[model samples]
Target: MIELNWEGVYPAVLTPFKENGDIDFEMFAKNTEAQIKAGVHGIIIAGSLGDAAVLEMDEKFELLTFTIKVVNGRVPVILNIAENTTKNAVNFAVKAKQLGADGLMLLPPMRYKADDREAVEYFKAVANATDLPILIYNNPVDYPVFVSLAMFEELQLCPTIKAVKESTRDLTNITRMKNRFRDRYKILAGVDTISLEALAVGADGWVFGLVDAFPKETVAMYNHVKNGEFAKALELYRWFMPLLELDIHPKLIQYIKLAATAEGISTPYLRAPRLPLVGEEAERINKVIADGIASRPKLD
Candidate 1:
């Protein structure tokens, strides 16, 4: 199993697409380069922010392979597994390791809303199938099943499950997890809006969304907080709140892609049933992105 310190900012990357709906590998590489250049600790592909549900299995593998090549080990590349069944999840986990994924952000059974036993068993089954380290994604606000701390007590028995992407959105859970487990699990702040607070309260890392577009600002915030420059971090965070709030919207993929486009990193092409933002929505989001770029903070 690969040893990951699992510390620092890891962006849940946006999957860039062409106008005709094909995966835009060129733009994808450009986006990856921006993250690497900004000194992000790692990158996550095929995540909720990346529109993983709409991607086919082959596309997922292709993105993972392509990302590894583009990254070239400059930073660790983690894949998100959103499978609905234990069997398929295990198969994908095995394949991800074989295809050179550094680690995984594993989600609970999709659509079924697995009970505590089923969720625990599902996670254990995947852990047993692979040697890859796992960050169990615990986002109850968006995903139906929430992996509670008690469930994590059971998961601790699985040695490879190393981290938690804590997007439960309750700030106290950060304190609760640390108080309960100590350093047993690395806690990554998964939601963007409250990320500074998460870092202030002792999250080990951030699994970010808007960082897909604003890598430098994201990395700056984390670095400031880590370096005990709380005032600097707060200054950036206050400026960053409007853009960070985009991560929580239902159409975040479109909104974030547009934000990236505004910054000249990625194009705003989304796969269907998901459409491009238009009219009032487009103008509104564009203004937010434009205003953010215009007033982007200058850090020293």
Candidate 2:
């Protein structure tokens, strides 16, 4: 298959839930349409931002299938197929290819945390499972047992590992990996807060949940960075700091959904064991979102 270019703004599509806490497939489609209409580069379905861990395999397949059908090849649809086991991740990777997914954004296994070599073998196994390309989701905060900089460099040399979302605050690692494997791998800025900086240091682009709430603003920010308008991008990125801060949290799905509800697009419902934000928690989050919106730069 052709090499994947996960370059530019890709929104981690949210899994919309109805009032009864069921998957609102219709709303999910509408929201996806909105992103496409707004000119996002690609769509990442069933990610952490989509609350994928709680979703059943059937639900994940349905969402991926629906996304591919609706997107209709207008833009690439990359599935976020992640699990703790190599077998499960490999199975999902195989399924994603069958559904015609363009690529994958994979999170490292979190439970009990595996050792370094075991982790490397996990990704290599997934890569070998299917012809579909993979992008490492380097979210160290949530998945504490992250791939080391050495391991990432090693994966970069592997042909099937197409891209990487470098979430670590250590810009050093990004620079190191890019210097060594810039020709083979695309380094996507996984942290919204550091997109501009990462972009400056040779990052290809971003796989962002921030784009979920403010597509135009996020697009503008990336464009500004691309155009070397550091001052303007910095201005915009700071204006978006509140939403940026929420991204590193494990409950980003909850607050982001609430923010969407405040935007009147969807309700803030979440699946079992993962409660929706409420009371003072939601009140505080609402304030941040409202404040950000108030200060958000004009879209048009």
Looking at model 1, residue 130 earns an lDDT score of 90
- Number of clashes in model 1? 0
Candidate 2 structure quality by residue, lDDT tens digits, 85-181: 8888889899889878888887776485778788888888888887777888887777786677688766754677888888877788788887776
TM-score winner: 1
Q: Please list all clashing residue pairs in model 2, or write none if there are none.
A: none
TM-score computed on alpha carbons, candidate 2: 0.93
Model 1, 135-246: lDDT tens digits are 9999988998889989999999999999999999999999999999999999999999999999889999999999999999999999999999999999999999999999
| Steric clash pairs (candidate 1) | none
CA displacement after TM-score superposition, residue 62 of candidate 2 (Å): 0.4
lDDT of each structure? 0.93, 0.80
Q: How well does model 1 score by local distance difference test?
A: 0.93
lDDT, candidate 1, at 175:
97
